[model samples]
Structure formats: C-alpha cells, structure tokens
Target: MTIRTFIKTTGSVALGLFVATLVVRGEESAGKAIAVRHSSTDDTATIQVAGLEKPLVVLHITDSHVTVADELEAQYQQYSSRMDKSYGGEKEHWRTKKKALPAAHFLNLLTLAKDRNVDLIALTGDIVNNPSQSSVRFIGKALNDTGIRRLYISGNHDWHYEGMPGSDDALRKTWTQERLLSLYPGRNPLCYAVQIGGINFVAIDNSTYQVTGEQLVFYEKETARGLPTVLLLHIPIYTPANTSASASSCCGNPVWGWETDHGFAIERRERWPKSGNLKSTTDFVDRVGKTGNLIAVLAGHTHKARTEKLSDSAVQYIAQAACNGGSRLVTFAPLMRDKN
Candidate 1:
C-alpha cells in the first residue's frame, strides 16, 4: 500500500485515542486559538493570529515512528515485504500498526507547516522508529526543504530499542553523533539552546530519566540570559501519581508502554548512574521555577497528546504524533505579567 493510505488508516485507529486527550484543561494551549477540522483533503489552512508582543508561529510535532530502512528491512524486504519478526506472535498485533506509520507522515506534516508558513518547527522526538540512517536522512532532508528553522531531540526509540537488550552500540551505528549534529548543531546535540524570533528554545536530552549535570549546567547558562525560554525534549519530568493516571505519568523510565511497568527485563534496563548524583527532580524543578523567563516545555513519547503544569510560569505540552497526520501549533505570545 502507498504511504499516505497506510497512515490514514493508522490515524483512523488513533483518532479515538486523540479524542480522549482533548478535555478542556484550562489554558493548556496557552490561551491561544486552536482549530481542528476533519475533511476529505489536505486538512490544512493558514491561521491569522495577532495580539502577542513577540509573535512566532511554531509547529510542534513528533513520533513519526517510521520504520524506514531498518537493518532487518534491508536484509528481509526483498524476501518479504512485511516488516515484523513475529516475536513468537506477540509482535503480530503491532506489525501492521508500525507499517501503518512511516516517514511519509512527516513529509505530509511538512506540507501543512509549509502551507501555514511556520517560522519554526520543533520535533520533540521519535522521528524515526529505530534511528535508521536511511530514515533520518529522509526526515532531515524533508524538514530542511520546508525552509523553516528546526529543533529536535531523540526519544527512547530514537536511541535504545524497546525490550531489546544492550543495543547502544547498534544505536550508535544508526544514530551517529554526526547525524545528530547535522540536525542539531552544538558541542552537545543532546542538550543546547538556540534563539529564533526573540525566544530561547532550549533542548535537553532527558531521553534518559536522569537530568545530567552537564545538561543542568547548560540550563543554568541558557536561563541566565533570561530570554523567554521554551524547553523541548523527548520525555516529561517526573510528576506524582494523580488520581488520573495520565496526569501523573511523565518520564518513560520504568518505561511506559504496551507491557506492564513491572518486570525484570524492563527494570534491568533502567539502571541508574554508578557515580555522581545529578540534581534531584525537586531541585531541578526549583531551578526552573527560579528561572523567571522560562515559559514553556514541549515533548512527546506517550504517542498520546497531553499537558501538565510545570511551574506557575511554565506548562508542558506533550504531543502524540506527527505520523498519523497530527501536528500542534504553538504561539509564544508577548510576556504578560500580573498587574499586582
């Protein structure tokens, strides 16, 4: 089947999940206007907006989950077009689901962004299913072709495999730092900050649960400048379990997914550092609280859109997928202060 047809089918399945996340969580979209329409066509239009001191249009998208050019696919595609290994049939259910999503959705989303003429695009993570060289190359070129400034981070899948053991070397081969640098330019692509249209867009590789000291240092330096900062990353920071599971859930270690969070395989995979204890979650959140200019946080991983407040000044916007023809628009309105 053609890529577009497959994603439309997957999106039909994901629509119910997307609807479940759309409760009126007060001010989650930052009091900006949002419109979603369903139709039989491109499903896009330009939105005219005003009333912000410094206005920048951002297209926030993620989790294309495109299983493009995997080593297995390279080895097996000629023999069999189907992409799953069967995993003793446990993998049976998801094989089609994976195939139903591809890098084509990213290209389609780029079309929407281009139509909207977005000033910037932030792909939160999981742009590819397994960080395959071919997938990354395709995504990078399409994104550049949009002629929009871009920012990104790697998700867990973008690095390590799901339930697969000790594949960091394999991951390194697929997601080479050079490839990482091409999309993200900095001494450390995993964490850095860039300025686009008078806002500080900070990206951190909280892809792992730990907040590395080096990342914290980068945070300090970037926030010191005191520009209105919008933090972007793969996973969310840990929040306490609320009555609603989704609200409480953030950060994917103890990894969140199809399987239960309790198991030897998953637990063994979630090892902590042997030496230095980086900042505590509270300490880091406290630092963010003090960073007066910090405004927003953007992320993806659950493959379900969500939002959770970080501090009085900051709210985290979690996206579901750009793969199933999904994208979110973020407007950084002029900084408004309480008139107390």
Candidate 2:
C-alpha cells in the first residue's frame, strides 16, 4: 500500500473524526497560525484552505490510538492474558508529552473545534491502537459529540487487532465499507464525498495499503465536478515535496532519505502479492495533478506533522497523531489561478 505503508503490525506502534453543517464562507485564509489551547498540551498550526468565499477552517486530527483503560483490566480477568503491552517509539511520546491516550484529550479537541468554528473536521484515521470493539466505540462516541459535520476514514490500526478478553476467535477484522458505514450516521461509504465551502472533500480508505479500482472510480467521479478538492485518507502519500526519492536505500529501509517507488504509488496487481495492488496508484495522483483541481491531499500515519508540494497546484498535508496531542489547523486560502 503506497498510501498506507504503516502498520507492519498492530503492536508495531503508530496510527490514530468529525462532522460539518453550515457552509460559513468568509475570506481566503491568510495561512496564519492560530493558537489553540488544550488542558494538558497547547498546540497550534497555520492552515490555508483554498477556494472558499471565506477561509474554511479545518482541523486535521489523526492517529488517536485509544482504548478504554477499564476494559483492559476486565479483559485480563477473563482471559488471564499477560500479553506484553509496553510500546515504544511513537507511544513513548504519549506517555512523556500528552500524559496518556485518554478520551478526555479527544473531547478537548472537539471543544476546541467548536470554539474556533471549524467548518469540517478531517479525521484521517486510526482511532485505536488495536481494533477493539470498545476502542471503536470510544471513537464513535467522540464523533457523535461534535455537532459540526465530519468526514472519517480508517487507518491500519483501526481494525488491525481484536485481542481482547473473549477467547473464542480474536482475529483481526479488516475494515470494510459496510462495517464502517454502519458505525457512522447516514450512509458514509468507504470512499465518499462531502461538499463544504465550495470545496469537494473526499474521504478515502487505503488502509489495506492499496487503493482499489472501485475507489479510483469513486474519486474520479467526485473530481469530475472540477471544484477545488481536498483528498482525505489514512496513509500519507510520499511525494518529492516531502520524501527524498533519490535518497539511498539499504534493503527496503531508507539509508539516506526515502524511496518513492512504492511509497508514492498504488502499484498494479501481480507486483505486490501479500496485498497486491488493485489499480494504478498513479491513477489517483495523476488525476489530481492533471485535473489541477485537487488543492490538498491530507493524510495521517506518520504521527508527525509535515507538508509537501504534491504538484504545482496541490499540497499534501500529513498531520500528526492525536495520541501525541497533535492536530493541524488548516485554513483554506484562495487557490492560485492559472491566469493563462
């Protein structure tokens, strides 16, 4: 999965919603950084939302890998499970910086969104560290709390593991269009579209690490409208703007910078067998570039905030995970015109 190269394993660490309503259009955002306060950690970002009567303020929150603390003890009692749960690397930040992955932190973010009057919230994915029913419920409840409309997508970890107490069949269930839509109100498909502030917001699921042929079709139809668009997804697409494609590589890991061959593309079938490609990864990026309408491609999986010039017209925004108490406040500035 070029898009979702993360999630080698559920325990491998890394991973992390909202709604919209009023089409409050104002002026193009000047791309200014507004300070947003949280009870525990204060975070801020400068955002440019393109092509709106007014700057459409969007909050990009990702990778809130949370599970109810109480549920864990219950599971232990039932299964007598002693699975090692110590996670390092990305999880370390939550312990040190954010205190812990408490649902309260997410509630704080929703409150901030309301206070700031964000138009729409793009939940790039991964609401749980592992796929537990309780974990999914926690995220679902959070989304319901936000009065504002939101677009939610799934990440690798969301449905990657089912390792709770009940010992019958605890296999990891992959997220499907059916299951996901059922969780959310109304009919939200695996790949769906929402219109906000004159921009087409597309929520896509590339959690399998591969974009399907059907997904390509779904996006193409949405972009055919030719309105300025923002693509929301789980994994961050590697572009020359952020990743060093020319960087040297050791085996598969980047020794110098990073490689683009697999990172940027949705490879075709027969190439990758484990999770072989369904359609050309280029199908999506190429369309965005050629059409020149997609202003931004926002994703999360890296658990760090970074931006890239995906093309002359569009910029890719990779937001940090909420487990680390992070969110990207994106203000859509007016899109640069061709003038040709």
Candidate 1: which stretches are off by over 4 Å?
1-53, 70-100, 161-174, 241-249, 252-282, 335-340
lDDT of 1 by residue, 1-340 (tens): 3322322211221211000011223432122221111111112212111223456888888777665565634643432232222111211112134333355556767887889888888988877655446666778888888889888877765654444445434444355463555667553665778888767789887665446666777787787674567798877765553235543335532334334333325323444434323444445545654454555678776666665545434556666566665667765544332232
lDDT of each: 0.55, 0.54
lDDT of 2 by residue, 134-190 (tens): 556677777777778788887765654333322111222334332354444664546
Lowest summed lDDT across 10 adjacent residues in model 1 is found at: 13-22
Among the numbered candidates, top TM-score falls to 1
Q: What is the lDDT of residue 163 in candidate 2?
A: 34
TM-score quality measure for candidate 1: 0.67
TM-score of each: 0.67, 0.66
Clash tally, candidates in order = 0, 26
**Model 2 alpha-carbon drift over 4 Å, by segment:** 1-51, 69-98, 162-179, 240-276, 334-340
